[model samples]
Target: MNSKKSKYHLLVLMDLSKASEAALKNAVHLAKEINGKVEVFHVKSPADVAKYENQFSAMRAIQEDTSNVQSKLMKLIREIEKEEKVVITLQISYGNAKQAIKDKIDSVKPDLVILGKRKNNLMNFLEPDITKFVLKECNANILISGEDNKFHSFDDISLGVYGETIHKEGLEIISDLKTNEEDPIRFFRIRNPNNSDKSVTTEQNKKWAVSYTFSEGENALDGLASYITGTNTQLFCIPRKQNENASWFGLSRINDLIYKLNIPVLILR
Candidate 1:
């Protein structure tokens, strides 16, 4: 998918939280940059509607709640359309938040799906992690907006390669974004201590100057986390698909980095 030549259709899951707001802003920024379209989506669960059903007289509480949310979302969409000069769409779904979002993704066929992380997540067993669930199930590319970090551009893009094959599709993703030619990109290739190689490479492409940094560490996720700690990366592009086994670091380790890194992660398929 040539993101630059293609008209991007971005779908953002707006929960009205600060993190979701950031995701919406980022999506709008990207859409304005590439002359794309934005779809702001929200989901309501039946249980939530039932809680407020009695408050309303006759109508299905869910319907009333949906109408109210639709109005607020429309207001937001209009503001964004006027400010960004981009076509914006509003969508609302009812039922389980996860299933509703998955269905929307299938129906919309958006180029990118934007999600936000919860702040101070308490890890309640009852509250399903929508972001993780969607990432695992959805087939489209995803942009997870970290609650602890906010970014407006992908000027400093970082790629973490942990003994895994680098795919051309990943590079295509960068090309599609149409990032600036002067933007700096760092590729960290992590290896174990015994296999460490201090050699570095610099390659100049049509749009970016890619620099390679070799680091030694036993745990791939930990090494990436350490590199992130000492760098000011606006985005992290990782080449891992959904439901596949976490090759280098365990699945739990990947989750740890996603939660702790506190930066936007672009999962490349």
Candidate 2:
């Protein structure tokens, strides 16, 4: 509480999953680099218990449930703040998770939204998955932390460039996250053998800091997975849309990669 107000605010979404905890811890790690603070937000649907809200007994039950969750979040926040030497706060609400997150982004206007995700076989069937919803609906930049993320400092970072316009902006965004001026960031240039016209300019390559081409033999997702796993890259930065037309990797490919890759990816909007 005594820490000075943070200029950068990171809003993290916690679903109480193991991934959520990793996201929060990782958010704290990122806060140090960005001079940021963390705000953990959890949302639940009360519709199941709404019918009983009219009943005094059921209303008490709902309130108790909310209170218990609040207590647990507060405890977690306190521990993280104390250990990380950073400030963190929690926000809890009951509603549709995706919509609630969108509302929070609008109201709080955090610089970034950190989301935790695990390998989900049912992601395709799970309508309105958090990653997809945020990518499409929310305007805030997003960092998706996989359950197995180590939350280490971003000593080694990679920016995946799938195309020209959308991806170039990612370089500028990721630069703002680095506290260490000497930190190295190289490009994992995704060669879309299909599109010869789309490529990174000299200026982008310079802004990119360095470059590494994705293996042409490998598919887009495969190359990305290989690079992230093969290198010490702790964080991967890329834009949500691969191109102006939003042709490919717009949602499905990136969403699929999120569940499969156990690394943190910052998807710029």
Candidate 3:
């Protein structure tokens, strides 16, 4: 287990929309609690402004609106800072939303990214789905905030392990969390007929309380959620797996769980 103290850093995607406030507030609180820094990103597309110039006025006007939104976001960050110690930075960029976010992630390298789940409607076209893109592309952990404003702790976490590919990364995450006093790590293996050998390998690790369950279907997220619901599990941890073809299965499943579950998720790459 790594003995290093955990330092938290977060990047939050902001658009000045109503759905973002809850996520921003939650991110601020988390930053305060974990003694971390928060970076807020607002992406602006110049092409969009030019394309809709007849509909909407100058690019300067759009820039001014973005600046105003950043100001309001900074004010909220200040409020959180006044009460606790946290470093806040804001960036307004002109480009594609996903590309801008990916660039920022490369430069800033925050531990996690917080995003708001917008309603599924026509407005989704205007409000780009950055979360989905980040999940697929970025190596950083992500937190998708729902309408509920509740904060969850990562203590007493669960790791839903599958194939042998994820074993090393999963153990590393659990070890780090356990070293930080986030104990009682529970491991759940999806039942498989062909993978009886893999199940035997997983059962060898008795350091933490482990449990085995049969998942009738291929959806590991549903099976894990069903097995652990009603328990005091706050966070679900998973590893990022990139295949030889460079496809990521762990991230896809993690994204599914993030939007479907109420609890926060932690993913390690």
lDDT against the true structure, per candidate, is 0.63, 0.67, 0.58
As a TM-score, model 3 comes out at 0.73
Top lDDT prediction, candidate number? 2
Worst lDDT window (10 residues) for model 3?
A: 119-128
Give candidate 2's error at residue 164 in angstroms. Answer: 4.7
Shift of residue 64 alpha carbon in model 1, Å: 1.5
Q: What C-alpha RMSD separates each model from the true structure? A: 5.0, 3.6, 5.4
Q: What's the distance in Å from true for residue 150, model 2?
A: 3.2
lDDT string for model 3 (149-240, tens) is 55444333354443334456345434544444334455444444443444223323444454455543667657667665545455555456
Runs of candidate 1 with Cα error greater than 4 angstroms are: 1-6, 51-59, 120-127, 148-151, 155-166, 181-184, 192-223, 241-246
Candidate number that wins on TM-score, 2 or 3: 2
The runs of at least 3 residues in candidate 2 whose Cα sits more than 4 Å from the true structure, single-residue gaps closed, are: 48-54, 119-128, 155-173, 179-184, 191-194, 197-208, 213-218
Between prediction 2 and prediction 3, the one with superior lDDT is: 2
lDDT of 1: 0.63
Q: Please, what are the lDDT tens digits per residue for candidate 2 over residues 1-269? A: 44776767899888666667878898888777666888888887776445674678777767888898888888888888888777788878887777787899999998888877665531221234556778778887888875574665643344443334434445455655543445445555555466554444434334544456643343667766777677756666666655432555557766666665666777777
Q: What does the lDDT read for residue 43 in candidate 1?
A: 81
